[model samples]
Target: MAIIPRLSTPQTSPDTGPARNNRRGMMWLAADLCFNIWALSIAKSLGVDLPPIQIVLVRALVGLAVLIPFVVWRGGMVRLANPKLQILRTMLSTIAMTGNFFAVAKLPFALFTTVNFTRPLLMMALAALILGERIRAKQWIAGGIGLIGVVIAVDPGSLGATSASGIGALFASVIAGTSAVIILRRMRNEDALTQMIWQTAGLSLTSVLPAIYFWQAPGDHWPILLSIGVLSQTAQFCFMRAHYWAEAGVIAPLGYFSLILSVTVGYFVFDEVPSIGLYLGAVLIIGAALMASHKGKRG
Candidate 1:
């Protein structure tokens, strides 16, 4: 249970200039990305034999339990705001989390992460449709290139690659992208803790029954599951705090380093060797995400 270190709490200073904020963001981003990637790999290993829903539900409950004490200490229920949006964002994000875990259990890590490259592209489209944001030509071009990468990596025509979990993860990424817009909107009114608390509570509530029905005894897997919960909670906090302290441009590029971590873990832990197509696709996707971020700034 003590396998993971406690994350340092981030403090925001109004007077901290861009240089300081950028450094802080990079540090937080690096820490959170590592924590999240590590947690996901562990979750996949432990949850492989167990029901995916059961594993995720336990993670949710553990996270909520962890947060309750902190939330109470930080003004309790009064900290929660914009109640309807919280529920909406929570459900959407949980759907994405559940889908990612479910997919991770079944798919190879490189392929799984490659398919996720579509998320930023999808977010652009979703923002245009949902948030009424306008898209630029560069975003469109980059997104098209990114889509090609995903198609190459996922290879929907392949019998083994396009399993139910693969398709499910693809669909979930789209939903997750859309949910992010709502979360961004809500961030203006809600603090990160409130959102984290509600998200855990919602995931636990929604997943409990399904988890129970599909439940297989985790047995010796409890410690890994607990660490998953702890790391994920910490990761979410770092993720939110990263954005809060710095601009999107500073944060976006640093995030792509996660690909390296995921690839390394996949090769060593699951013996998943990346194909040439997987590498190419990862390049396209990461490039597209970076371009999209730059495009947003230009607009």
Candidate 2:
């Protein structure tokens, strides 16, 4: 799943003051940060020689296993209504998942993450075009800065670096951004639990064909494969809860902390460190996200 900004009113208690809201918001940000870090780690681990479809299937199956209990506890299978939208969401999610897995498997974690970070910028543009939301000048500037960061991260000078995997990741970013825009626009109309259920169920069913055709036995990698699904579901659960407690503007910028987590993990786990150019690019991207968050709050 993609991390999108959730613009919601902070939950407040009858006795508590603004201090409570601040505390809850901070907790939400922490949760969001932790979720992304775990997600990136799982993605990196699963990148080892497995086909994207196989990884995704394992992820879907695990998500379904977790989701089944929740759905049953809530109201059983009948709770899954809106079959058509669920199908569409699932198809889009599958495409995004395939692109993301392929990119992670092929590119450096830092580079892949830098490219993925472009989602916020893409979200701004798509919000205007698809949702008819007005685009502010600040939003445009942030988007431009983010684009510069992407260019720097994906340096054309690097030999054999700009492969189809990189291109696919870029496409995935766009798809993910668009999905977020839609979710943000429709947040009021749908509950978070409902959205989560649809995504999990839809992707699980839709991906069956690709998973079947490209099916590789889990082999000795069952632990890793299971981890991917379980961690992903946990992240989604945390993200959904976070949204209920805090505003998207506050939580969204924290999502960039994933870069730091990825870089650290890449270094220790893979002994791969980001170049100075990559660091500079990361700063630019992060700055843009901060600016956008500030603008979003003001508006």
Candidate 3:
């Protein structure tokens, strides 16, 4: 999952020093990852019947609705900076989210989640390309390893309809999501809540018309629909708090748990028994991500 930009807060408060906060941060990050996966999994389950656009619309609307009161409570949208960049980032985020919903519906849960692990590699490359950051040899090697893992899991030789189109959507979503994160890193001075409001509002607006055109009255699934928004936004809150409380390296290992969660959920909840290739590929992907993150921290 993409890490939400850090909220504006002091690095260390008198009430909680670095050690205590680091522990708290890791816990929050773990919760955030769990909620995020659960939200996506719920969307995937719903996607079996509902239109992907409609699901995206509901998620975005619920997210926006939840943010409105918070925005009002903290005084109106007065903290925004770099409006153009914000719009650009929001547009990428919208594309990323819509594509993610589409992929979740089409791909196996395990495959989809594993493919997402490549986002860090993509982000690292984007940093080098867009931000003109130097790419060390080890990082490049990690990216190569991640790509190989993806190929192993995808098994391009057996490209059926399942792997072909969903793979495209999955990668597109990951790239767009990585781009949004790159932009977020650029907007470090911008208020985190303001960025979130813009994102939710943008997603809602972009998806509304399509949703209306393809409108299906969520019927009995309204509760599930509502939960997507609630869970996702809560997860985003945890993500922001996690960053505020600790360095990325301190919380990085917890991210590997997502794969275990994905595999378990895929098997039990979705009855997806991935082949041995998937397990092998996942190991390589996770190892590469860990190496990249570690090198990133050191750099």
Indicate the residue-level lDDT of 258 in model 3.
Answer: 85
**What is the TM-score of candidate 2?**
0.84
lDDT of 2 at 221: 78
Best by lDDT: 3
- Residue 103 accuracy (lDDT) in model 2: 75
Residues 1-299 of candidate 2 have per-residue lDDT tens digits of: 42233455545567873223545765766776676567656766766567787777778888777667667676865444455555665676777787777777677777777777777767777778777989879878998998898778776667375455556665675676468446545554665556666676777777888788988887887887787777676676667666556666666766777787778878888788788988888888888867765643443
Residue 230, candidate 2: alpha-carbon lDDT:
70
List the candidate numbers ranked by TM-score, top first. 3, 1, 2
lDDT of 3 by residue, 10-34 (tens): 5566776544378888988999899
Candidate 2 C-alpha error for residue 40, in Å: 3.3
How many residue pairs clash (N, CA or C atoms closer than 3 angstroms) in each of the candidate models, in the order given?
0, 1, 0
Between prediction 2 and prediction 3, the one with superior TM-score is 3
All models: lDDT?
0.74, 0.70, 0.82
Cα-based lDDT at residue 172, candidate 2: 74
